[model samples]
Target chain A: MNKSSAPRQSLGELLPKLVVAPTFVVAVIFIYGFMLMNAWLSFSSSRMLPKYDWAGFIQYEKLFANDRWWVAAENLFIFGVLFIVICLLLGLFMAIFLDQKIRAEGAIRTIYLYPMALSFIVTGTAWKWILNPELGIQRLVREMGFESFTFDWLVNTDMAIYTVVIAGVWQSSGFVMALCLAGLRGVDDNIIKAAKVDGASMPLIYRKIIIPGLRPVFFSAFIILTHIAIKSFDLIIALTGGGPGFATDVPATFMYTFSFTRGQIGLGSAASMMMLMAVIAIIVPYLYSELREKNNEH
Target chain B: MNIKRVLIYSILGFAALIYLLPLVVMVITSLKDLDEIRSGTLLSMPQALNFDSWDKAWGAACTGVSCEGLKGYFWNSVLIVVPAVIISTVIGALNGYVLTKWKFRGSTLFFGMLLIGTMIPFQVVLLPMARMLGFLGLAGTTSGLIMVHIIYGLAFTTLFFRNYYISIPSELVNAARIDGAGFWMIFHRIILPLSIPIIVVSVIWQFTQIWNDFLFGVVYSSGDSQPITVALNNLVNTSTGVKEYNVDMAAAIIAALPTLFVYIVAGKYFVKGLTAGAVKG
Candidate 1:
């Protein structure tokens, strides 16, 4: 609406470029620049504060030799695998059952999907209460006459990680159900009908004819879930505080603990770099094929 | 056939309870006193529908060293989220317009770089970003946190808009160009009028994310500038005091209310935003 500023042809040509330049520069510096800084910090002898001097492979060596890092890595495997598999299986079953000619589908779907909307902090807090041995399910069980019932995973070092898995599954499995439902809606009706005509049962039709067609949905779900699993800091902090003696420390919490809380910036940087590598290892291929597919379709 | 139908409904009902229990427990537990919480079961109803814990969690309970509860931190989140969401959405719309309608040479590569920004684990960037904030003398300030959110949030906002604007045919822009429309003029007249849906998606996504964020809030900001998520975590995990589960649950629910409200209201857009960016964390 300003009078003379708009009609200039040169200004029009330059304005779009100018508009985007700041964000572009920011992306380059903050995203790329910060990553380079971490990589450099990892290789340097950074302790309390960041030092730019090179001390090659020392942090990585320390990281590898650390028992806590190994525990975190092993925890990531157990957490990641169980989280993904349980979510997929539970999500698939829920989606299939809901896809039937069911009543109140919208209401039920909202109940299942509402957890996705809550912060992981909230999820963790609620679960922390639910899993607390003295105040939670174990006490409730004992009150109900099961005198020796012991569901004390919250304080149990060996089983504390699975409490995390339970909470993780509770928070995330619903999203998987949403994804599978979308995929199910996209399934060709004629194919399912033909399979039915051939006397294939419903489960057989889903397993043999339908579920395999859902690989793309499964792929997208897998990538998102894995990324969430890797970047999971808040939930672990809220639920476990990486505690019961750091038994539930994943890479995210591990990085936070060393770099900020403990002031071992070098070790923390290494942990962060490993996390970045895990994301890259998963994402590079995902992005490559994703972008390629988009291009092919366009 | 009847058995199969019964089985499906029962399974669904059971699954719904699993998802609903924690939320119900959170609300009920927040309404109960320490005595009631101790005496009754986890799922027990409160004695008298007490407002004691809610008042304490909102106004009096300790978060870090402050006796002021989640009310201050709640405002901090609102202040930060409002500016960050608006600024990121506007910039994202402009960037999307250029990347799609005004495709200059090498813009694709530029967009690719921005896309990569979305996937970089935040842990990798924490040290440098913190130092960068200190260097700029913005550490421990709300403005610095806003800047950080806008920067990281740009990638997802851009992705949402670009994917949306691409579905807009370019011939409309070409026609407007022939009628002597300039860049901002065309954007004001054409693209903006058509961008309401994607703008909803971007705003909802951004609002929910920034409101719920703890990583940047915990690391970069300190003292009074901490967001509600950080404050809630500190309040719940504080080692000194006797654990007040009622106050803790109340604070958690308070921290969760905004996003849950948005999800209940414009949940179609929320779900659209989630499915729209599969790459989003």
Candidate 2:
């Protein structure tokens, strides 16, 4: 064999090298790098200053002991479940209804989606005013000669969290509807025709056939919505500030209160860490299912 | 598309009105004077339409020492959101490119890590990220807020771009390689051009995320550096001061104008952008 014609091993070697090396470098430096740094800070006696002295799970211990932390965690579960389920059902309903080839579909679709365009701050304040008992719907209805109609949920201790859920669902469901609408549009009309030929009612066909087929789309929407609800701070902060005496408090608000409002850095970090853990606990399983489903499809 | 369809649309139309009721109230309230807002129904039209509250909200509303309305905070928001959006999206693109084209050892682990980053609530990262910013001597500054946005924005943007790139054929990367293009060159020349839809998506998402941010802005900025969200919160959420409902509504509208404008102007694109990687992949 001629020496030069030994087929240039450089190309083959460089292929993996070029593709692999830079990726490893960037991921290590940027993604996991910051995460590890955060994890390390959680372990230290760091407050305003990040001293690397080992606190040995002291922060984690205190995190569980805190009442506010517990409340925040509890609120997360409530808010997450309520928001996700409502948005999913409402989104699916809208998607299914809109898929019925109704007139003015485009205009109606835009109307639904307009809320996602506004920031949470806008949504929060707008809804806050609309829900305010003294100035909003309750007051409006009462003044209209109905003395018994009360919609004071935004201000009520027990009901404030539900108000957050309501606003949240309103703000996000349109986008979810859009997502499901795209998925619905992707469904083959032949499937619907087949169901019709088999004497299935529209609602029955949707429950039996269309829904089963839209699993991947529904899962995608669920993952996105759940993540959104987990990381929810803006809507809660803007709407209630976790207030009416911590009634609407979630992990985000709890972390914020300790970290910024009270200036209890160590306790704040503990709350923060707990929140991170809770979110991961919620997200990991769903993500695993989604990933597994994708692999199975392939 | 007959009488039955017409009835269905009428029901949807009514539902759409209910969905828009709060916003309609906000707009109607924005147009009314303090007196009308105090006495008149929110859904009802103003007795005399007035722009005085809007004028005050945009320029004359007091937030601390500044009597200037939300317009004063406008530049600060621009200062924060512009750099925050651009930097975060660029990093997202790079991460997406690397994750897709360069499948290395531990790439799955790294991707998993990014997904975890997305899942972790901002509340959880609040203290540590704040402390980290303070340690870097960047806390309570515009730059600090931008850094926070970048970190928070990273996971979602990366997810967006990664899903988007998945739709493009792997051969694109191989072809770029065969042409002897470098990583940045391939991304800029090939991937970026095809990424307009996703880029729009990220931009819209980031704009809403950063612009609407309250807790981060509140904790990370003070006085002159406060973004409009914080200022608007203060204006409406005064601890003891009389709540001016008209001004507050006006302030909220003013704060939201920029993002809302972008949405309306690019309304078609905004809707499409959100649904881009949602289904086909």
Q: Over the stretch A1-298, how does candidate 1's per-residue lDDT look in tens digits?
A: 4735676776667777888999888988999988999999999999999999999999999999999999999999999999999999999899999999889998999898888888888899999998999889888888999999999998988998899999999988998998899999999999999889999998899889899999888999999889888999999999999989999999999999999989999999999999999999999998788778879998
DockQ class, candidate 2: acceptable
Q: Cα deviation in Å at residue A238, candidate 2?
A: 2.4
TM-score of 2: 0.88
Tens digits of per-residue lDDT, candidate 1, B73-123, equal: 999999899999999999998999999999888888989899888777899
User: Candidate 2: misplaced stretches above 4 Å?
Assistant: A1-52, A55-61, B1-3, B102-109, B170-189, B239-241, B272-281
Candidate 2 has which clashing residue pairs, if any? B59-B69
How far residue B139's Cα lies from its native spot in candidate 1, in Å, is 0.7
DockQ of each: 0.78, 0.43
For TM-score, the strongest prediction is: 1
Per-model interface RMSD values are 1.0, 3.5
User: What are the candidates' C-alpha RMSDs?
Assistant: 2.1, 4.4
